[model samples]
Structures are given as C-alpha cells and as structure tokens.
Target: MKQYTLLLAEDEPFLGKVVKESLEKKGYAVMLAPDGKQAWQLYTSFEFDMCILDVMMPYKDGFTLAAQIRQANPKIPLMFLTAKADIRDVTQGYASGGNDYLKKPFSLDELFLRVAELLKRASPENQPADEFTIGSYSFSPKRQELKDSDGTIVKLSHKESQLLVLLLQNKNLVMDRKATLLKLWGDDNFFNTRNMDVYITRLRKKLHKDPAIEIVNIRGFGYKLIC
Candidate 1:
C-alpha cells in the first residue's frame, strides 16, 4: 500500500494525538501541527495529499489557513474538523475551499468514510479535464479553480469542481439531476438532493463575478450552464 501524507492541524493536544494515531494506524503519514500558523508553515515546507484542520487555533484560524492553503494548491483535499455547527460557519468552510466539514464529537469511522470519499472523488486520474476554459474564467480541473482575467482565482471544493466540469461538458444542455447525484454522491436521497441545491447556489455565487456565466436551473429535472 502506498503511503499518503496528511497534514493534521489541531490545538487540542489529546484529540490531535488520538486522531493522528488513528490515522497512522490506517497507513497515513500524518504531520501534526499544533496551531494554524505552524500548520501553514508546515504546509509550505512539505507536500501533503490531504489536510484536516481544526476551526479554532492560535496565531491563525482554520478558515484563514484553509484559504491560504487553497491559494497555494486548490486540488489538495481539505476537511475542517470543528465544534462550530452554525450554518454560517459551514457556509464559510465551503467558501474558504473545503471539500468536507465534520463537526466535533464525530465518530472516527465517519471521518474515515468522508476522507475516503473526498480522496476518491478528487483523484487526478478520475478528473475530467486537467484544464479548460469557461466564459471569462480559466478552469483547471486539476487545481479545482476558476482563474479570471484579473488573476483572481476562485478555489472550489471537490464537489463544486466536479459539478463545474459536468456543467461545462454539457453547456446549454440539460444535465440530469439524478444522474449527477448518482455520479458524484452515489445517491439521490432527499438530504443529498437539498445539499446539491446549496452547492449549486454557491457555485453560482462563485462564478457571479463573470457576468456572462450562469448556472440556470432546468425546471424540476436538471440544470444548464448558460454562457
């Protein structure tokens, strides 16, 4: 089995140690960073395949660190592990470029599942396009971003990036909601359906800077990306 590098940032020593040891047992080489500043420093100094960050930390916060890390490498999978469950915080996590959000008091098995899902979905070999263009933004599937003319790069979560690729692949045509749900999430349940709605709204907002781009809903069936 290949060893995957993971950056684990947590201010709580006990919890961090537990999580780090648990992951290490699963064959991951985890670099534990006690604070967000140190996490950022470690991130810059070493290469990591995934990042697991705590929301609150000294010197820097998880959301801020996530943004900085996103700027450096958008495609690297990131997850926020925190006690904050406010809707605003969850929204911020996604906007700051996180692939998954797990609240504290979470089960280790659940964390493992989320991590595996994110990594499988974000694997480079499974990605659609390494790089492409959409309206005024240059889309890089590998980086999971939309770089604008002004050099503004909007980083996307794994699902958001995958959604964009599907939309771009079938621009001006209706893409099935159920098919999308199954492909990306492996299910079309009510909860996942509503979650997809939120993601669509976020993606629209992210691309709103470019007036020509739009992700238009297609009645009750699907969506069409109009450019």
Candidate 2:
C-alpha cells in the first residue's frame, strides 16, 4: 500500500503528538512542526501530499506559511485548524488559500475524515508524464530531474518538482495565487507570500539557461509558465 506524506503544523505539544500518532496509526507518514516557521521549513525541505496548518503560532503564522507554500507548489491540498469560528475568521482562512477549515475542540474522527478527504482530493489527477520537454530543458517528473541539451542535469527539490509538474499540467492557463497557496503551503499569509517569492526566484534561476522557458508573474493574479 502507498503511504501519503502529511505535514502537520501545530504549536500545542499534546495536540500535536495526538494528531501525529493518530495519523501514523492510519499508515500515513506524518511530520510534525511545532511552529509555523518550522512547518514552512519542513514543507520546503520534503515532499508532502497534504498540509494541515494551525492558524495561530509563534515566529510565523499559519496563513503566512501557507501563502509561501502556494507560491512554490500550487496544486497541493491545504486545510486549516483553528479555534476561531467566526464568519470573518473562516472567510479570512479561505482567502488565505485554505481549501477547508476545521474549528478547534473537534473530535479525532472529524480530523481523520478531513485528512482523508483532502488526501483523496489531492491524489494525482492522471497518470504521471514520463518525460517533458520545455524549451531546451527535458524534465522527467517521475525522477524529479531536468536535463539540458548539453547533458547538464539539474536536480529539483520536491516542491520545485511538484510546482513544475503543476505548471506543465495546466500549461497556458493562469494558475491563480490563492489556488496555488491553498494547494502548496496550506494557507496564505504575509510570511508565506515572502517564502513563495524566494522559491520563485530559485526556480527562475534554475531555468535561466533556457530563454524560451519563462515563469511570468501576472501582477495581481498568479504565475504563467511560457515555453
């Protein structure tokens, strides 16, 4: 059986432990981060199928982290856990790139259901492409590698590879900022937005060798990959 990777960001120690254990019991690989900042770091460093973020945290907030994640990989599923149940808070959560929001003091059953639903929704849409040609760059999504005509191989981080795949899957379409944030980082906030900028810069640098490959910023919208 294939195990899905889940990143859980929560500051409360006891709750984090319980959540991790529960998910692990279900055969999911769970990585727990004590704070939003650490969560963002873990997310960028590894590949996670879905993210569950706690709205409030130290150093960086969940929303901010989610925004950053969106900028890097726009097609991942994002869910939020929070105590605030006000309409404004829910709306804000959605605005910040949350696909689903769960209020605090909830049951373990609810959590499990939500996680399962997200994982199901995030499952890859179609069969993975064996090879992709973008300008002078050749990409193998399965291997997460990009090679140039000169035989120079550029390895991509998990998030980088995932982002590229999403862009290629939706080629010629404008992937909106909110959609990307919700999918990747699991939330959209100020800090996450900054993090996204960094990833975008890194991606641009990696593709700089190919003039025909352009990742364009559409101002108030999202990004467009032109090949």
lDDT of every predicted structure (CA atoms) = 0.87, 0.83
lDDT by residue (tens digit), candidate 1, 44-135: 99999899999999999999999999999978989999999776887788789887788898899978877776777678776686788788
User: lDDT: which candidate is best?
Assistant: 1
Structural similarity to truth (TM-score) of each candidate: 0.64, 0.56
Q: Which residue segments of model 1 deviate by more than 4 Å? A: 129-227
Superposed by TM-score, candidate 1 places the C-alpha of residue 14 at a distance from the truth, in angstroms, of 0.8
Instruction: Report the poorest 10 consecutive residues by lDDT, candidate 1.
Output: 182-191
Across 21-66, the per-residue lDDT of candidate 2 in tens digits comes to 9989989999999999899889989999999999999999988888
